[model samples]
Target: MSRERPIPSNGIVVLGASGMLGRAWRELLEELGINSRFLGRDECDITDAASIRRAIDGWPIVVNCAAYTDVDGAEAFEDEATRINGEAVAVLGAACIETGARLVHYSTDYVFNGQRDWAPATAPPYRTDEPRDPVNAYGRSKAVGESLLEPLIDSGKLDALIIRTSWVYAPWGKNFVLTIAKLASERDELTVVNDQYGRPTSALGLAETTLTLLENLVEPGIWHATDGGRCAWFDFATAIAEKTESGCVVKPCGSDQFPRPAKRPAFSVLDLSETEEVIGPMSPWEDRLDQVLIQAGLANKRRLRKARK
Candidate 1:
């Protein structure tokens, strides 16, 4: 209801504009007739304060989609990761403050320890006010960014909102759905890790929710924007197989079977109580997948038929 209120054509600038989420948000902004400036890593190095300041010189809203998303790679290159993920955010926050601009940022569910469940079958959902306990380098970096920007928000130099999401996927980038779909078509059988559970958020869905929030930029805080369901990686892979492929033998395996360098949270399903309370119930994961597949032009009869075998 609040988003229905109009925003003047002050123009929104989105960083990471070439990435999956950035592209999706760009498309939606175009549809809404809200002109946006897209700054890629090369165009405006977020690591440089002056670069960030100059890029956002005239924009009123700065949506920072730029992030170091390599979870395991962060383990090996924490400094570079921190420079991009943590310190860059502070610089951008400062730029937003100087420009009198609102900063919208992306965070991860990894901020919490996997031992704690945000959503319980018989209890209320986790509030945005819950304490964070990051378990890994990447999570720690993101937590640091969240900490660095707090002062800006407090001083009223910046009106910042952080959107913490889990298991983001999109057709435009390298993600689980695209990987699974490609594997299903190429391989005869596959074994997927089944032990991990989280919400599979489509980038398009996040982009739409962000636009809705921007349309009502006055209402700002940390919000969760993800698809409205939960499933294990294997379950999600199976769903992709089912939707894109009529039938594919997607067997369940464990993280032990295909272990990686970084330790992933066993449960990363973020409760959407706060976001849904603001934006209404999000579309289901399967529905979101369908839309993405169509958008990617991967839902053709031939592709589906090849995936089925």
Candidate 2:
């Protein structure tokens, strides 16, 4: 078990507050009565060194959720992606070091090439110490970001935690679940890729786990986090359709059927042993999804009831 720490007096500064994971973290903090300051891209340009220093100057904790997430778009704009996802993070690390602020940065499974396929029934998920070989522009950019923080963490110049997660979705924002839910409602049939394998992580659960880490003052290092269990994208989509009562027929297909500019890994399931040891086992993906959907449904009902009044 990790040692406990008192919450920072200045509260946390959440960068990229408008993004999906950031919003989820904000919601979780509010529910738990933790104080935090949220800053969107418009409010704080992470790429700007002055902006980063200014935003984090007084805060004792900084949670960075900003990133260049467009996988396909990255192929065409690798430089821009590197600037935001890689270079900017280095600047943030320096700022954290100077201000004595603990930095909590989010990373992705794309840091690994995903060439090695794992059978969940037999093989353990990819460990945290696995070699990284990112396959696409997006992955390379994220890998660079991680590399920038390594030295700072190694020398103890900055107190940092780099958490890598995958296939994250929430009720809000542009995520796989929301996309599938919309298509299932409007389309009669949908073809999804089945070759890709990974855990479908919930933003809400990830947020909660992050808070747990902060409260426990877990050691600063690389950790893998996601909802428990694994499934292919096709299975994920089908489950969503079933849960939402969407009449769409989901058909599985190979990645070749719908080729994109960037290549995707066949398997990217992350091992959560290290994370679990620190914060306990995460909720299963299906259960998290069901909870989000239920909450969304109830929120909608309240909205409708209010409108009627």
Candidate 3:
């Protein structure tokens, strides 16, 4: 389900320490007592080669979590997103190469178009070897980063791994779980898009699993990491509301009902075969969600209510 292993002796430096994923990494590293340094955007401007080089010079493992994560906003600021998710990655990769540091970078399932002519029942998960066919600007921007980094990895010029995950959530941060839980407490009814489906990855679990991968000495290339099982956004929302023990009624609706600038994939599930082969079966998404909610004390709502009475 969840795992942790010894990290490198030279220590790790985490970028994007201000973001949700970054904070998870920080927490995990601290728990493990691994010598680590976490840097936010203000401290480390990845777009600047000098800043990137300075950050990478001493660390043996470089974990990059920084990115322009706004999916809908990317439609309007594609260039800015590209500058961060794409161009900045190129610079960071170069710095890693120069410093001889192994890189661990995160990407999204959005890199795939999430459409197929085949029957939905039999459609296979997106393999690592699949071609890039993004449906939205955010996906395209991430695809650009993959394009720049894949060549380096294939050529054996850079020692790095790119992990593609979906619907990432953590105890702290602006994520689907917290959003739905909050709304369920305030509103009587909530509508979520039912057409979209993908696996959910717990940031805490992901951070630990990532360390486990490193402990196993996996190769430098693309890999998928998410909790086991798949579900639509509505299904996930319902699970969150239930976990929080809220009275909010969750309703399903098509994506068209709540339009946004970005065109999200109907199905963005990444193939976890390779990942599972390495780390064994992942914990089910519901189990992972429960663990996280409990950690955040959201699961204690009902207990607190009973205590109040």
Candidate 4:
């Protein structure tokens, strides 16, 4: 992000537009009747600067949802993760600068080490300016992008907006919600970790709120976006179980119960005060979850709630 105002014209180019979050952005743009063009990795390989330039040339704004998103895989494939999620961003940033386009990049909360593990009940949300101390290779890779771009932003050489979101799920694509929903449907019981705590985000709600931020001309800088409240992974999985009415007993257990290749933060909730100040409070993750479950035909229609504008 830079000091200059971040605004874009009607036409938008969404790289990695076939991903879950990308589809959300595409659907929102179509619903709003905005002109937006989407490109898959084959059409616009972000690793190549020329491809990025070609894809984003005429668009006033470039929303990049692309990244090496595998957290656990990063431990073994750190180099590949760094190349795609870390290095390619340098190319994207340069292309955006050359094309004179406003760049909107998505980041993750894993950039933090979640040192608040000792005090989950009293843990505070991580701020945008916090010193990054990632605990895993995936987080390290993402941190590489933030590190590379901050200097350019400080020098007033780039026009960009880095938005950080977490625990994303949608009606389509692979995600925790769908996995738990399907498992709950087939299994009588499930075990979820109760140690990790973070906010859940709906891809649709996130897309809409991002559009609202663009419309409101919020400051061009690092910002955090997510649902209204925070909860443990066990809580989230349990909620999905109840919503699906799969009659699955979701048992809570410590993180040690099931280890992962990636070491996730114990407290990764991002502070939303900055984002809320501009776009109003976010819709509850539960309400947003209901919308997605309904779309996936996993929730009862009676659980419907009003969607965000």
Candidate 5:
């Protein structure tokens, strides 16, 4: 268990506050009664060091939710992705170090190369201590970000928590769940990749877990967080279809059938034993999805309330 610490009341600054994860983090912090501030890209350009320093000057804690997350798009634009994901992390870590502020940064399972195809489904989750060998351009960029931020942490100039997650979705924003739900509603049938396996994490749920750590001040290092179970994209889409009251039949297909410029991990299901031990267990993806859809007015309110509670 992580020992609790006093959270400075200088007001938390959420970088990329307008993004999906950033919005969820802001909402969760408000619910927790924490003083929070959100800075959008226009307000603070992460790529610009001066902008980041100015925005983080007063905050005692910083949560970096900004990143170029277009996985496939990153392949052709690795430099741009590196500028945002890699260089920005280094800049934030340095600023946090100088300001004596703690930083919580979000990462992805793409950091791990999915070389093992026979990983168990719904088995032991990925731990923070696991080996990481990213396969694609996006993964490489994130890996570089993690590496660059390590020095500040080792020097104790900054306290950092790196969270590696997968399949994050939310009510508003361009996520797999909303995207699949909309596709299903518009089409009669959908073909989703069934071969690639991972956890379907709700941005809201991830936000809650993130708040729990911040409020408790979980040990500064790396952590793995996601919903309770794991499944393929098809299964995740199927759940979204059921929640949104869509009639589309979700057909399972291999990743090869839907090849893109970037290569996705075939088995990136993370083991969350350490994370769950420190905080309470994460809710299943289906339950979280149902609640999100209800919040979005796409699901039955009464049933959703019951399931969430």
Candidate 6:
């Protein structure tokens, strides 16, 4: 709730403003009376150093939401993914270091391999310091980006904070929640993967948390930021169906049933102990989901009307 910040008066620069998270950040900033400049892919080619420099030249704070998020396509075009996700990030990091601007970069849970034998059954949420073993090309690319910034951050040359989040969905983007909501309304039965486990975070909540971190002047380091609690994709879908009154039956299916080009972590729930201690606790996923549904105009109006009867 605290809105005071450590940021400068120059205003924030947002990269990838056309994306889901970027849009959410823009909305949140406006609501909080903060000044920001948003740049889409056309305005700033992150992979090009000159373009990145032009975008963040005078800005004192930069929030990077751009990423090569095509998990399946990354298998065939790892080079493209690397250029955008890895190399581009390094370029941005270097530029931020040169300008002395605070950089808030986003990473993914895919950085870890699905096999967490350390806590097999209910695999404990991965800790921030845990070893990263990316299984697929997309994950590897993200890991490469994280590695590129490590030395700069360690040596106190770059003022940066990396936040690793999972299964992020927003009202305005192509995401799992929106997909499921649409499918449930049209289909009589829907099948979702039950083996995959992680928290579904709302982009709106994430944006608020990022602002809170800035307001508190939290230390520059890697942290996990997601809605509290976890569930399988199937469970998440069922919740969506129930909330929207879509009258669709959600069935659980094994991950092996539907193959994907990129191997996703079976259990990538991130440990939020450090994040909670530093920036306060996040709302439960169920609560955040309701808010998102209301914003998207997909809440269970039929159910509510029936109850009123």
Global local distance difference test of model 1: 0.81
Off by over 4 Å in 1: 1-3, 117-126, 300-309
Better of 5 and 6 by TM-score: 6
lDDT of 1 by residue, 1-309 (tens): 245856558788989888878888888788878878888889888898888988898888888999899999999988888898899999898888777888899998888776643442333334566777787899989988888887777776778998888888987788989998888878778899987777889998898887787776535567888898778889888887777753578999988999787788777778787677767898889778877887777676555445547
lDDT of 2 by residue, 1-309 (tens): 233665776688999999999999899878767778899999899999999988888898999999999999999999999999999999999999999999999988988878764463455678988877999999999999999998899888889999999999998999998889888989999999988889888898888787778788888988888998889999999877877777789999999999999999788999999889877788888778777776666223443334336
The CA-based lDDT of model 6 is what? 0.89
lDDT tens digits, residue span 1-309, model 3: 334555667899999999999999999989888899999998898888888887878899999999999999999999999999999998899889988999999999999998966554357888998998999999999999989999999999999999999999999999999889999999999999998889999999899878878877799999989888888899999988876879899999999999999999988888999988988998889888888888898897556446336
- In terms of TM-score, how similar is model 4 to the real structure? 0.94
- The global C-alpha lDDT for each of the candidates, from Candidate 1 onward, is 0.81, 0.87, 0.89, 0.87, 0.84, 0.89
Compose the digit string of candidate 5's lDDT tens values, residues 68-95: 9999999999999999999989988988
TM-score of each: 0.92, 0.93, 0.95, 0.94, 0.93, 0.95
Which of the numbered candidates is closest to the native, going by highest TM-score?
Answer: 6
Give the range of the ten consecutive residues with the poorest summed lDDT in model 4: 1-10
Total backbone collisions for each predicted model: 0, 0, 0, 0, 4, 0
lDDT of 1 at 265: 74
Which regions of candidate 6 fall more than 4 Å away from where they truly are? 118-121, 300-309
As for candidate 6, its clashing pairs are none
The global Cα lDDT (0 to 1) of model 3 is: 0.89
C-alpha RMSD between model 2 and the true structure: 4.6
- After TM-score superposition, what is the CA distance of residue 158 in candidate 1 from its true location, in Å? 2.0
lDDT of 2 at 184: 90
